[model samples]
Structure formats: structure tokens, C-alpha cells
Target: MSMVINKQLPLPVLLKEEYPLPPWAAQAKVRRDEEIRKIFTGESDKFIVLIGPCSADNEDAVCDYVSRLAKLGEQLSQRLMLIPRIYTNKPRTTGEGYKGMLHQPEPDKAPDLLAGITAIRKMHIRAIVETGLTAADEMLYPENRSYLDDLLSYEAVGARSVEDQQHRLTASSLDIPVGMKNPTSGDFSVMLNSVTAAQHPHNFIYRGNDVTTSGNPLAHVILRGGVDKYGACMPNYHYEDLVRLLEMYEKRPLENPAAIIDVNHSNSNKQHKEQIRIVSEVLHSRNYNPKLKKLIKGVMVESYLEEGCQTIGGEHIYGKSITDPCLGWEDTQRLLYKIAENC
Candidate 1:
């Protein structure tokens, strides 16, 4: 009863037509999707590191960061799959702040949905064609998935959005692996239940039309740590925490019972530097237990060309995060190599 219609944007189909992905890039995406899906399905031993800027605010910087990842991906192709996190959609918990490139293509500029849509599409397409990479994005807005679905190899349901019905249903319809993160409450059952919902067939209203999905067997869990009632970070990436997840998975019928540990977020208590230690420990846990290794496929790292974050509307620092702080490039490269060696 209290809303303003700012503009009637074009549908996803029209947007796709306006900015089409090249045939070669589309083919590349197909192969990348298959390869990444295998990792989630337990068919590949390769580990995935979804690393990049916290929010893809600048096209040139994000692409430059991903270009470096493409080289690293080739260097460790056999053991690691470096999927850059070109996240255009961001969830603002308090309903304010920089919501990501999808809200404003430029961080300091006014929100322009039309230009933002164009910017995100162009950036994603460039990553595929120029760098030979298919990136991951957060499904912050379930209704907007179709806009860039063809370009994404992996998608994630944020801890805040995991419990939403639309997000669960959207994950069910997606063809690529969709990560359902444990909620802020850190309830294992909530995350597992969302995965179950996403792995089952459903007929639902999507984009104002009735749609039926065959269901996505690659729906899995992401442990990003959680927040307690008193607002303290509670980690669950320890060996015992993973063992609990394994036992829970054993009792569920969820397909592709996999978990990706988010190295930043609550897991690191937002200390960007702690990502290195978290990754090392998780990798060690996998080595200690073979079964745990299979269930824990990979990790998500928030990193960029520069270390840490800067406030939006202030003087911009190229390749640094404007949202959450991220690990810097030098540290990221060294740590990635360390992970590959251990893997």
C-alpha cells in the first residue's frame, strides 16, 4: 500500500538479447558448469576456491582480478578450480548501503537499475571470453536470476537469504550448483533442509508464470559460520563440526551432500587476514579424514587485487572491496599456491 514504481525494467529475455554472450563463451560456460558441477557431485577431486572482490563494483578491476585467477586456474587445473566470485547482487541486511553492482554500476553514483543490469552482464561476458572463466554470484534477488543465469557457473544463497522460499525454489530450478549457507543462527538443520527443498522437484510461480523444475541435484551446503543471540561469531569449520554435518548428511536423502567452507564472514569474524589460517585448517581436516574430504568439496574466499576495504563515496581504491574487507592479492596468490600444494 506504500510503494513507488520508479521504472518498469525490461525482462531478462530482452536483456539477454541486448547483450548476448558469444557462442565461444557460451560453449566455455557449458564446459565450466559441467566441471564445477562434478566437484559438487563428488565426481571430481578438484577443490574450488570462489575468490574475488566482495562486491563487483568496478568492471575493469574485477576483470583484472579474475584474469589473474584464470592463469592460476590453469596452473592448478588438475587439483584446484578457481572460480572468481563476480558477485553483482549483494544483500544489505539493514536495507541500506551499497547493495552491489546490480544496484549501482559505480559505487558513488546514484542507483540506475538499467545501467547496472548492462554493466553486470558486460562484465560477466568479458570474464568468460577474455579470461576463460565462468564466475559465481550470490542469488540475492531470486526473481532476477534469469538475467545472468547463462553466464554463471556457480551460485550461492546467502545466510540471510537461505531460508526464503523463493530462493529455495529458485535453487531447485537452477542447473548449476547452488550453495545454501547456514543461517545466522548457525542451525545445521535449516541449511540441510534448504538443500533438501532445492534438490526436489517443484512447480512454482516464477516471473509471473507457472514453471516446473526437474530439480537440482547439485544443491549443497556452505558453512559461513554464524551469529549468536548476543551477536558474537560462532564458527563451525572445525573437525567436530564437520563430523556432525557428515552424520546429518548420512541421515538425509539430499543429493550431492557437499559443503563449501566460507573462509571469511563469521568464520574469520570478519578479520580478512584470518582467511589464510581458516583455509589451511579446513584443508588439514579433509586430509585427516577421507570421508570428511569427500563431503567438504571446497572453500569460498573473499579476496581482491588490494587488501581490506574502503568506504563508498570516499576516494576509491582500485580492486579493493567496498562492502566486506577481503584478502589482498599478494597474500591470496601465496595462500592459493599453498592450498594447491596441500591438496
Candidate 2:
């Protein structure tokens, strides 16, 4: 064989068996799950906010961030349903750079799949137990999702992988809310088609077994903006763009015609500081139009204990981002309070 077959890590079942959630944590998860699902089903008028670092690079920092968010969530429970983002797997555009904690638990160390897996699981469990918060992680590797699916409350299919057959199929099987982002080309049809595929039943081979899924009704869309032919970012989270998406959704049969705007990606042209302005503009649009508010369920923000980003292996800041620039804790806190007031 050309590639080496490394030793296999424990399966998701065995891992959970060994480190199962406590009864209290499990009950908390159930309550949080329903609360989040209600937003997708339109049963709850509260807006959902998925905010955290771009990737969970450090367990201590990530846990601390979620702990603070958990406190804020309690106070804003009536207006906002905050789900901390614990994205462990990052998709590199050219298959390079730090591929998140799942690839290398330590930023300076070499890749260790086994250790990475254990670290991610432990980090997620700790967040829930320590803060009573359920998180949202990207489904970067469909097969790897099984490792964390039981613990995640929300999932996202990144723009690069939205059209993949395996990703769509795996999303179909998930019971929780899954957000499918528009491709880099900004093709809404491709994203909507993925949603359609996810919201209908399908049978596919998975993990050496034939698995059939009844389909996930909560699968929805995420607008992360797009890149132009000249490689410039073209945002699609504007009022007109949202109206266009609403028209498209009206034609589709997807159960929950909703979208969550990603404020830090191409939408803000990767300018992390633009996140605050973007949120304010989107909120203004929601306030101006009733239909738009009904279609936009939430916003996804990249934030951490510190602002901006640093190259990996450099003099790293304690809570700054390693993958992308993010909003600092103070600004993030101010923005959250503002959003609550608007809500």
C-alpha cells in the first residue's frame, strides 16, 4: 500500500461509553436542544446567535470563552439563544496550515490523530459540564462527525463541502439544525439543492455499512458571501440579497426557510472589525422588514477573549485566534448587549 495505515482510535461508541455524559449534563443538553430547535421551527421568537473563536485551538481558552457566554446567555435567555461555536476541524483552502485541534491538538506539535480525537471530545464535554452550553461545530469530515455528533447541538457544512454527496447525505441523517453555506462561487441554487437533498430521505453507504436516513427537516442555509472572478469578496447578506434568498426559499419546499449570516467571512471581506457594523446593518434590515426578520434566524460571529490573529508558532496571545482574525472580548460583550437590546 502506498499510504501507511495508522493504529485505529477507539470508536465513538466506546469513547462515549468510557466518558459518558453525566445525568445532569445530559438533561441540560435535552433542554438546550429543544430551545434551539424551537428557533428553527419558528416556535420561539428568540433569535439565535452562534458566536465563538474560528477554531477551538486551546481548551482552557475555549472553555473560558464559553463559560462567559453561558453567563450572558442566562441573562438574555428570553431574546437570544446563544450557542458557542466549538469548530475543531478547519478546512484549508490549499490543504495547508493548522487544520484545527482535531489535526494537531497542540499548535506547535506534529499531527497525532488519536490525541487530537481525545482532546476534542474532552474539550466539548468540559464546555457542557462547566457551562451548561451546547456548541456548534463544523462537519468538516463526515466520517469524523460520529465522534462528536452526540454532543453537538448544531452543525454546519462549510462552503467548500456543501455540494459533496457524502456531506449532504450525512447531513440528511442529523436530527439537529444543520446550516449549509453558499459555495465560494456564490451560487444559491447549489446551496438550496443541498438543503433539498438534506431535507429528504436517502440511503447511502457509510462507515462500511448501508445507512438509510429519513432526512433532516432542520437543514437550512448560511450566507457567508462569495468571491468574485477577480478574487474579491462580494457579500450577499444585504437587504436585497436577503430578499432574493427569500424569493428562492418561497419556491422550495424546505421546511424551515431560514439562513444565518456569517459576519466574519467574505461577508465582511475577512475584516474582523466589520463584524460589528455588519450585525448592526442586518439588525436594521430585520427591523425594517418583517419578512426578512422571519427568514433570518441568527448571525454567526468569530470572537474570542482577545482581538485579531497571530501566526501559529509565534509569540501567541492567550485567547486570540490562530486561524482567522476575531472580535476581542470587550467588543464582543458590547455587541452582544446591543443585540439583546435590539431583540
Candidate 3:
């Protein structure tokens, strides 16, 4: 004879959905799809600029910044395609600091993840509907993609997670253009692998169920520099390096031949001011290298209303970053004009 033991089920918790997008979100999505199609079809030669704060912690600040960017985007529509980075989540190196608006809406208080996630989604939707400008964000959590997948024009798989199979698979199914950064060690092989993985169809388990992907044909590469024991930035947008990388990319068939150069992070050696100088350098080099020029599409910069960064758990200064230091609005504007003139 056998005896059975019963376990009690957990109690249900009712949470409010605090953030929801307005009706205009649908129209914005349609425009974004048209823009993406133009980019991939060679109908648009405009440089795609992904610019914004290191992390979007405040909704009002981000909205103000995007409003300004959208106006400038309209003024420079012929030369550049602006995609404001509305990144609401941050991936940590050691699992410390405020992760993003999705984890702590109040900052340093009890976590209200339900509210945080909703807040982020609502903000993303607002960026598109209110400004009529496309948005870009780093996809950290695979499950979170569904929340804003319909609103984003572009997505980035950061250096830290580019090598992960799950992330690569997730990229395959993404509806918008995806950019995969090279590994932290500055190796291009991982990114190449990522591009290959994202270009082909994939089948995987998702949300406790089986799913298949038709692959993201618009997937591309982002050179954000890399680090090693010597702590130097890898592939410094040099003529030789860009030539070699493009050769490799051409030798093997890829979903897309274009690449986005990130002017921040290891590329600028983490110096906020260096972003402008690096952009100028790349533009100059691209002028002489035809092959490199053809493969290069645009650039990425981390900028905010103010320059530099702040302590995450410390007093809130507002408009500054809690992670990496960013270029101020004035400098960011100057850089944009310079790229337009040079490119």
C-alpha cells in the first residue's frame, strides 16, 4: 500500500497594468515597416543613427529628448535616418546597480516589476506615436521582446550576449532589423557566427512551447570595439581592419552586407568626448576605402540631455546616465551635422 501527499498551490496575486500605448501606435508601426523595407532594398542611402541615453530611467526626460531628435531628423532626412535609443533595460557586468526602468521604476526601493515593465512598454509606444520617429533598443531578455516588438524599428544584441544561442535564435524571429555586436574580446568570429545563425531559419522552445522562425534577413553587424588583457579597443575602424572584415563578410553569404559602427563603449575607450572624434575619423577613412564605404551603413552613439554619468543609488541629478557616461545634447547635435556634411 502506498500513501500520497498533497501540496498546496500558491495564492493568486492581482497586479494592475499601469502602462498602455495610445491608438496611434498602430500607424507608427506601419511607417517603421516601410522605412525598414527601404533600407534593405537599397532605396535609402541615409546613414542610420541610433542615438540616446545610456539608459532611459525617466519617461519625461526621454520624451523631451526624442522630440528634439525628431525635429532634427526631419531636417536631415535626406542624409540620415535617426533611430532614438529608448533602451529601458540595462545588462549588468557583475549584477549590481539599477538594472533599468523595467526593474526599478522608483529607484532603490521595493521592486514593482509589473509596473516597471508596463512603464517601459508605454514609453516605447509613445516614442513612435508622438514623435513619428523610429526607436532602437538592446534586447536583453528574450521574453520581453513581445512587449515592444511591434513598435521598434531596430534592435541590438549586445556584445555580452551575442554569442548565446538563445539570443541568436531570438534574433532570427525578430520582425525588425537586428544588429549583433562582436564579442567583448574583440573577436569578429562570434559576430559572424551570430549573423549566420540569425540569417537561417531556426526552431526552438519558447514560452513553454515550440516555435519556428523564418530568420531575420535584415540582421547586420555592429563594431563597438572589444577589450583584452591589455585593455585596448579592438577593430578601431581602421582602413585595413574594415577592409579585412568586409572581405570575410563577402566571402561568405550573409543576410545583409551592411554594418553599424558604435562610437561609444570600447570604441571610444569609454570616454564620452571621444565619441565625436571617432565619428569624424570613420567618416574620413570611409571616403578613401570604397569597399569599406560600401559595406558601412551608419553609426551608433550614446548621448543624453546632459554629459557624463551619475550614481545609480545616489541622489538623482536628472537627465544624466546611471551607467556609462554619455555625450551632451550640444555635442551630439554637432556630431550629427558633421556626419551629414562629411558623409
Which ten-residue region of model 2 has the weakest summed lDDT?
A: 13-22
Best-first order by lDDT: 2, 1, 3
User: Candidate 1 — worst ten consecutive residues by lDDT sum?
Assistant: 311-320
| lDDT tens per residue, model 2, 1-343 | 6998788788888888877888989889989899888899899889889999999999999999999999988888889999999999999999988999999999889999889988999999999999999899999999998888779999999999999999999999998999999999999999999999999999999988999999999999999999999999999989999999999999987797899999879999989999999999889888889998898999999999999998888688899999899999999899999998885
Clashing pairs in 2: none
lDDT string for model 1 (1-343, tens) is: 7999999999999999999999888998888888888888778899888889889989999999999989987988888999899999888889888888888997788899988888899999998888999999999999887899889999999999999999999899999999999999999999999999999989999999999988899999999999999999999999999999999999997777899999889999999999999999999999999999899989999999999999987678888899899999999989989999997
Q: Of the candidates numbered 1 and 3, which has the greater TM-score value?
A: 1
Question: lDDT for every model?
Answer: 0.91, 0.93, 0.82
Candidate 2: where is the Cα deviation over 4 Å? Answer: none
Candidate 1's error at 75, in angstroms?
0.9
Q: Write candidate 3's Cα lDDT for 1-343 as tens digits.
A: 5975443322111111234445576776677677865775467777778899999988888988999999988888888888899888888889977888888886667656667767777787677767987688889987676666766888999999899999999999987888999889988888889999998899999756699999988888999888988876665566666777898897888856888899888888889898888888888778888766677888899999989998867678778887899998998888888888888
Local distance difference test, candidate 2: 0.93
Clash-forming residue pairs, model 1: none
TM-scores of the models, in the given order? 0.98, 0.99, 0.91
